[model samples]
Target: MHQLVATPFGGRGLILRPGSTKAVQLPLARFEELRALASALSTVPQWLIGPVRAQWNVDLTSRSVGDAILVREAGPYEFSRATWEINLGCDLDCSICYLGEKKFEGLDMDGKRKLLAVMRDAGVIWLQITGGEPLIDRDFPESYQIAHEMGMLLELLSNGSRLRKPHILNLLRTFPPAKLTLSVYGATAETYDTVTRRRGGFDRFREGLEQAVDAGLNIDLSLIIVQENAHEVEAMRDWARQLGVPYREYANISPTIHGTAEPLPSQSPQYLTNRAPFTGCPAGVTFFHADPFGRASICKVGREPNIDLIAEGVEGLTRLGGIAESLMLRTGGCSGCKLSDSCRVCRPMAKVFQEAKAPLVNYCQHGMR
Candidate 1:
């Protein structure tokens, strides 16, 4: 049996056996049996028989740590999951950008180690690097290299403003295409500038996209829907279609956790009303978010640490009531709602419990009537 050790960020994971260790995809594609295996072996008491067990070595080196203690809590990956934040810093001053006020400690190389360790330990196969704009970071490439080295899939979420630079374009060509995701704010300069609040942003974004496309890089586009650009969604979709890539709109949510000074005015009714049926939020389940400081928790938007990535490890994450129970305790308004399938509240709503000193809320889900 292989032992699993967790890395720093609750992402990245590694599996270790007697003489060999290698990276394993995370969230463990076949986790149901893992627990049973652990249970079956638990009776043997690892300390009493660990050395004997070492004779049956396998080759899997986890990214988190060197050979040390046996870690039983690890998982492999589930492709549907992806992390979308690279750094908190961004150049665009869009009115809706919620992370603007938050302070970025500036993730350094060591932090990258923690991040890589976590993702590798978690078996997170794909990481989506995002930020104010990832290209602005001088160490962006270094971070990319680490993910690539760990064999984790990579995707970059950027404003596409830096693509016009030949050097930047050249640098990007070194990576695999299946691992990148880009953000295009608008289909045209007028619309782009309106959303970015920068006069030349549209042209820059377009120029960058052109460069990326020319380089034959794999890219996905994300659009933020707002009053000004709501109508542009179809146009942007058509443009993405022309590029032979997929595009989607994400409603603007406040960046309170990123340390932004003020949350974007609670998402507008229009945006909220149009939300698609909720999938009960996959936080702490298929995917989890970590605070800049390496704290792991149920939701990226929630900010506070419901679970600590560094201390708990993968086993800790599962022991914390598992995802389903944790979601019930951490989420709001799940008491008597028949429309649970349509509710969109996340950890932020958990605040209702925190503020009222209650365990949960009494509200009904959408379509309660």
Candidate 2:
């Protein structure tokens, strides 16, 4: 039988075995040591140390009284969360956009249905829609309705260009979004337009956001920091505060890697990415991404195909399951991180690259407090 044992010393530590739970407080120095140990364990056979490692930081264990545990061959698995790229097309061409150099073609309804069928079969209960602009896809609301009808929770990431259209806003209102993440290019039009490379974008984004809030959607701000606007962090954060929404800052990854819509030099690693590698990436575990290109990835940016949901269908996902893989991958840059307890590493990044990979450096490495 297996059980879960978490000790406070490890800051959200998990030990598998049958036993009662207790808490322990250690000096910050000792806590750091435990964090390192946990990060290391992420690389090896975590299951052998206890029971199965589930996704989203869940540790699955069997009890002497529970069902028999079966060991099976490893294969692609079903998805828990699905990312639907409505349109590869975007209105703005940012120099640092990860998908900027990539094409922004929209997905047809048939493609959307095929992807949804795959997700439905995989028992994916959650869906996140993103794009050059999801609103650019005429059938987006229909797609959302399909996912909602299938009982999947929905999250949307948009640039806020189309929200000014009452019908579009009405369509958006169809789903009580679990969360709506609006990308904030800058605090002011000059800064915002510069990043989005679009004229009058700040106005549209602001108006759309107000409508979204008026529609009673849970809003979150997504900010991308670059050399040009890095200093605007406080200002951007203040804007989010004014909107009464939480903000998440994403460092730019190499845009060339994803073949975005426009040609832009890759941002420097100093501002391009974060150093706090989350040990708990939700890939294969709790989430997965299916792009319009007919490729399914463990993460969003890279289109590495673990399975083709379009071809093999969602059943192909179960064949390439996630929990086990997530456990095997070490949390990068998190080797000696202090936020282990609260920080969940980018599972998608860790899964694609090794813990020792150079890009794993997170914010901690940049001297950010």
Q: For model 2, how big is the CA root-mean-square deviation?
A: 14.1
| Candidate 1 lDDT by residue in tens digits, 1-369 | 113322312443333222122333335432333334344543322322333345334223221222322334434543224464556766677766656563455556777667667766675655666675777777777777776556555666678888888777876776543545676666778888877778998888888887788777867788676666776778988898998876766764544444443334433436544344445666666666655555555555554545555555555556333644445553443555555565555545534333434322222233333
- Which lDDT value does model 1 have at 142? 79
Against the hidden true structure, what lDDT does model 2 obtain? Answer: 0.59
Q: Which lDDT values do the candidates have, in the order given?
A: 0.56, 0.59
True-structure lDDT of candidate 1:
0.56
Give the runs in model 1 whose Cα sits over 4 Å from its true position. 1-84, 98-100, 177-179, 231-234, 251-273, 279-281, 306-324, 330-338, 341-369
The CA lDDT at 239 in model 2 is 82
